[model samples]
Target: MDLTTLTYIVVGFTFALYIGIAIWARAGTTGEYYVAGKGVNPVANGMATAADWMSAASFISMAGLIAFMGYDASVYLLGWTGGYVLLAMLLAPYLRKFGKFTVPEFIGDRFYSKTARVIAVVCLIVASLTYVIGQMKGIGVAFSRFLETDYTTGLFIGMAIVFFYAVLGGMKGITYTQIAQYVVLIFAYTVPAIFISLQLTGNPLPQLGLGSTLEAGGGGYLLQTLDRILVDLGFTQYTTMEEGNGFNMMMLTMSLMIGTAGLPHVIVRFFTVPRVRDARKSAGWALVFIAILYTTAPAVGAMSYFNLINTVKPGEVGAEASNLLYEERPDWFKNWEQTGLLAWEDKNGDGRIQYYNDGNEQFAQTATEQYGWQGNELTVDRDIMVMANPEIANLPNWVIALVVAGGLAAALSTAAGLLMAISSAVSHDLIKGIFNPGISEKGELLSARLAMAGAVLFAGYLGLNPPGFAAQVVALAFGLAASSLFPVLMLGIFNKRMNSAGAMTGMLVGLTSTLVYIFTYKGWLFIPGTNMLPNTAEYWFLGIQPESFGALGALLNVTAAYLVSKVTAPPPEHIQHLVEDVRVPRSAKEAPAH
Candidate 1:
């Protein structure tokens, strides 16, 4: 079958699988809807959590960002994965033992105030909404490419699929669907890497293949060869550290680690495990599953970068024979052109494609004076790196179809998880918890579904107009979570005297600071014409980009929370006991019934 037809089949099959799982796992009770009745096995829960955590950002955008940023992109790999350890050691088991259905439940009860829970619900909504925007973009991109539709139409289709499963099944449905999604997404991700790895190196494992010698039998390491190729094209060395960006990377990593730990969708995964031990074990399992992709991402990025350069410059860099004739480009190049993601202009009117660093003035001068090249004539969008990988490698059509399914899986799984988090916070935390304590179970469930539907619509609308690259948009979510939610959760559990007033003040401070910083640079809530400052590095506060400002905001949260708590009354004795109870673990048989 042709690539388009195969893609339709594979994608249709995956959607059927998700809808089937949703029907089988549909929740009948509020307990089932919210926490899967707390009966999930540790390993199964782990796979679902892996799917939830490794969203479109990880699957579609991370490697592409790495392809361009090189070593600087390690912040994402290390930062995102490192948080599981923090979750396992510090948060997940305790939250599981607390036996709460939502994050705001834990915060409200622990702080002994409805106001605190309301604040938490707000933070959860903001963080989750920001996160879902990226997922929506990924969904649109995946659908747009594979289904050959416009972004808006693709987004509507993706949103409908998520609404069917997410609204029908809730957490119970999302859990099992995510498990299937993890399998499909992980398989789809690895197969392309394996094929590309085997083509470039004798080694099959991408991790090892990155360091292996090129298949051309040169003694030079693959990374070394890649470095030489990039440098020859006037780009930075592929394997070397970039100057003046180390601090930004470190701070960004810190933000992602803490932000991940604080995210409500991920934290709520623990709530579905039957026991505290299961929660811990599930986190470990999640790490193992996630590491499969994380370890391979750097290799994928490096290899993809190398492959792109190698394709454009087939002979020697800066030589006329190396350049691809614009009129004679490959089918893959022409394919991406339809997406408007890949473009070429004969700037020098030379009738050839010159892919080089137009940003480097010195290189442009040399190219113009010596090589008869005007400037960089090819513009390849970074977001298309992984999506275009199979095509770039000239892999079979089925593999290409599988990649579309994989991208959709990643985006949909995470979007469902986030919508669940948002809907739960609204229905379970705000509506049921504060506004109407006596709501019927059926009413609450209906409310949850409606909230989810609304969230899907809002996110789909934003997907039509994204703020930046999908991964960069996700970074904003992480920054907000780190600055606001993570600190309060950590303090609420670890500090016995933390009161509602202090926690609320801290969250407000953190949330406001991060939002203000991002708005000043990115625009007020990412409106196109409202930015107050240039987003350049030179305009950054202390050389930190808006994306990296979360670390500073988190520090301000800690300090403000501490100072506020000093002047506030300590938690009442019952709240103190509640904290201690959650802190200690119990065996399955001995654990107090929720």
Candidate 2:
């Protein structure tokens, strides 16, 4: 079948699977709707969690970013997966043992303060909404390309598909659906990688293939070959990171870690497990599943770099009389060309395409002497890396269809999970817990569904008019999570002395500081062009870029909490017991007992 037809088949079949799962596991009770009735096995829950956690950024944008950034992109791989290690070790089991429907429930009861719950609800909403917006935007982009629909129409269709399963099934329904999604996404990710790997290296494994010898360079190491090829074309060494700031990289890693641990959707996944032990085991399983793609993505990037340079350069450096002109570029090149992602300007009046390391001083002079080029004419969009990979490698049409399905699966699954988090926070924590204690379980479920629908609409609207790249939105979401949420949850779990005053104060301080910092430079909520000043490497604090400042915000939160807690009274004895119980999975037998 053709690419478009196969794409429809894969997408249609996946939608049917999700809807079928939703119907099979209808949420009759609030517990079922919120936590999948806490009966899911560790392995299944782990797969579901993997689906929930690996958003479009992981599925689509990560390889593209790595393709361009080289060694610097390792931070993303390490930070994203490493944060799950932190979550599994420090947070997941405790939260599950606490037997809470939502994150706010643990914070409110553990701190003996309704005020704490309110604060948590706000943080959850902000984090989930911003994140959902990112996922929806991803869905729209994938759909527009694959289904051949307009972006808005694609977004609406995606929103409707998610709404069908997420609202009907809630957590119970979404769980099974995500397992299938994980299967689809992971397969799609690995197959192309495996083909590309074997094509470039004798090795079939992408991770190993990354460091393997190149076929084109007569047994030279792939990285070394890339360095030579790109350098000859005016690009920097492929393996070495540019000399910018190492401290900022460290901070960026920390921020993503804390932010990941702070995210409510991921935390809530633990509660789906049958027991506290299951929660811990599920976390371990989740990390394992995630590592599969994380390990392979770097390989994909390196291979893609090889392919990209080869595609652009085409013939040998000295053989070509003139470079590829704008009119003579391939269909793939021209398609991306229209998006302004792929640009070729005839600098120095040369008809040839000039793609190189424009930022490297060493290559600048060599490029001038050799190619007579002015600059890197390659204006390829980073988002196009994965989407264009199959074409770059000359893969079959079915693999290409699988890529679309995989991107959709990644986007839709995460979006559904985030919407569930948002809806549950509004209905379970804010509406039912605070606003109307007398509200029935059924009423709350209805409200939650309505909230999910409303959130999807808002996110879909934003998706149609996306703010930035998937990775950019993902980074911003992480920064917010680290700054606004992680500290409060940590204190609630480990420190019994944290009272309402301290918890609320810490959240406000952390949230305020991070937002102000981001807005001061990123413009009010990152709309752009309204910054206090241009964010330059010169003006930052100790070389702390806003993107890498989540760690600082987290430290600030912890400090604020300790100082405030020292002045405030301790939480009640019952609250103290709650903390101790939450720390142990063995004592979880009676948690959900009737």
Top-lDDT structure, candidate number: 1
TM-score of each: 0.98, 0.95
lDDT score, candidate 1, position 32:
94
The residue-level lDDT of candidate 2 at 486 comes to 93
Candidate 1 backbone collisions, by pair: none
Alpha carbon lDDT of residue 162, candidate 2?
Answer: 92
* Candidate 2: worst-modelled 10 consecutive residues by lDDT: 585-594
lDDT of 2 by residue, 316-408 (tens): 564554356656767667655544445777777767676766777766776677656677766776777887788778899898888888989
lDDT of 1 by residue, 1-594 (tens): 899999999999999999999999999999999999999999999999999999999999999999998878888988899988999999998888888899999999988899999988999998899999999989888877778997888899999999999999999999999999999999999999999999999688999998898888376888888778778888888777788988998999999999999999999999998877899999999999999999989988988988887787777766777798877888888888887778899898878889888788988899889988888898887888889999999999999999899999999999999999999999999899999999999999999999999999998877887898889999999999999999999998899888888899999999999999999998976889899999999999888998888888899998899999999899899888888878865554648535
lDDT of model 1 at position 487: 95
Candidate topping TM-score: 1
Which segments of model 2 are wrong by more than 4 Å? 315-322, 338-340, 347-349, 361-372, 465-467, 584-594
